[model samples]
Target: MDKIIYAILISNDRQDELTRLLSGIRGISDSNLFNITYNDISVVASDFSSNKIIVDKEFAIDYARVIEDLAQHFTLLPVRFGTLMESPDAINEILIKYYDEFKQNLQKVENKYEFSLKVLWDYEKCSGKIRLKTESEDQNAAKLFHNNSVSTEYLLKKIKEHRFESALLEHVEQLIGEISTRLAQLNPIHKFQKMVTPNIILDAVFLLEKHKKDEFIQAIDHLKSQHDDLNFLLTGPWPPYNFVEITLK
Candidate 1:
């Protein structure tokens, strides 16, 4: 049977505690969960048949659930779903090879949780306002080009479109700046994606100290109150899925 690895965690002399915890939690296909330890770190895993496993949403969710449960009890680096090895010896070899990398990552996420925030707006309404503003400004520039040739008109239109895009981008950047400034005091390690979609202006994830969870939510609430035109959807006190930066060989 192949071993499907769930997470690599800092065992920290808690071997007996970890054993008791895994005994109650189920892995994929209701398989028993166990730990393979080396020094102070351990890899959580379960028996799996690589050939027979269903590669589907349900299996993925089950895999994530096991990692999530482990995270609640230990500081862990979640293994990618479906990570399999031929035997415990292979897993031990990996543990020996990447021990330092795993230790560093686990330390970084030791007492932190991940949170997601998405800022959305009515694209049509917001873009229309920007378009109107840009068009009004363009009219002044249009007066300079007295030659009303076909190509000239087309160039002017394109220029207006470019200006509108630049302005929209500027607006998004300003918003991101404000958010960063507001959360600077909390000192979260954050990643932000701008313009994920027309409506979803900002898609962001933050690795925050677990004890500061309430303060983070309150800060988001205050931000939402200030931006009545935009919708804020904040989720998680979850495992640091986005913040983990290691790739297992």
Candidate 2:
């Protein structure tokens, strides 16, 4: 049977505790969950047959549930969904080979949780506001194009599109800057993706201390109050999903 791995965890002194935890949780398809320990590290896994298991949404959710449960009790690096090894020996060898990297990543996210924030706006309304501010800049653009004797309807149209994109990007950056300043006191590690779509202006994730979860939420609420035109959707206190950076081929 293949072992479907869920997470790589720091076992250390929690060996017995981890055992009890796994005993109560069910792996995908309700398979019995078990630990394969290698020194201070461990892999959470279950017996699985890749050919028999239907690799679909429900299966993936069940797999994630196991990892999520374990993460609540342990500091772990979540193995990507669908990870499997042919045998216990194969898992142990990989654990031994990547022990240091695993340990380092586990330590980095020891007491932190990942949180995501998506900021959305009414695109048409926001665009109208931006257009008002850009009318002067558009005139300057037209003047420059005219001076070059390169003015054409298509060229001006392209310039307007470019200007709108630039303006929108600048707006998102300013918003990100304000958000960073507001959260700087909390000192969480964060990442941002701006302008994912016209309506979805910013998508951000923060790896925050578990103890500060409430503070983070309140901070976001205050930010929301400050920006009535934008909507904020915040989710998590999740397993450090966005913070892990390891690849074992």
Candidate 3:
């Protein structure tokens, strides 16, 4: 049987306490959860028969819930869904091998919680406005294409559209800058993905100190007030899923 790993946690000198905590929470397939420890760190895992494991959305969520519960009291690196090993000794070998890196990462996230922010806008409305602005700015662009061959006209149109798209991206970057500026006071470690979709202009995640969560929410609420044209969807105080920087081979 393979054991599915949920998280890597710092048990410190609290193995007994960690044991008590695991006793109360069930893992995937309602299996009893337990820890395999080496020194100060441990792996939360449950018995999972590889042939019987169902890789489905429900099971994935159950896996995350187990990690979520562990993260409530321990600073942990959540294991990716479907991670499995043959034995506790194998798990112990990994912990011994990666002890320093794991300890460093645990220190990095010691008291921090992760939050996500997505900025959305009306695609048609925003693009329409941008097109108008681009046209107004480039009124003389049409004159440069006076030859008027079909190919020339087509290329010119594409150029203008490219300019409009570039302008929209610049606008999004500007909004990101504003958000970063507002969040500078809180000093979070963040990552961003711009224009993930036509309507989703900004997808961002932040790792902030746990005690600063309320202030972070208030900051986002204030930011929402400033940008009437965009919708801000902020989620979490979640485990630092997006911020995990390690991969166990």
**Candidate 2 clash pair list:** none
Candidate 1 scores a C-alpha RMSD against the true structure in Å of 1.3
For each candidate, the alpha-carbon lDDT, in order, equals: 0.90, 0.89, 0.91
Residue 98 miss distance in model 1 (angstroms):
0.6
Give the C-alpha lDDT of model 3: 0.91
Q: Least lDDT summed over 10 consecutive residues: which range in candidate 1? A: 240-249
lDDT (10s digit) by residue, model 3, range 1-249: 888899999999999999999999999989999898888999999999967776899998999999999999999998888888999899989999999988898889899999999999999998898888999867667877768799888888888888898998898889889989999899999998989999998899999999999999999999999999989999998998987788777
**What would the TM-score be for candidate 3 when compared with the true structure?**
0.97
| Global local distance difference test of model 1 | 0.90
- In model 3, state the lDDT of residue 81: 84
Order candidates by lDDT, high to low. 3, 1, 2
- For 97-178, candidate 1 gives per-residue lDDT tens digits of 9999999999999999999999999999988888888887888768768899998999888888899999889888888788
In model 2, the runs with Cα more than 4 Å from the true position are 145-151
Write down the RMSD of all candidates, one decimal each: 1.3, 1.7, 1.1
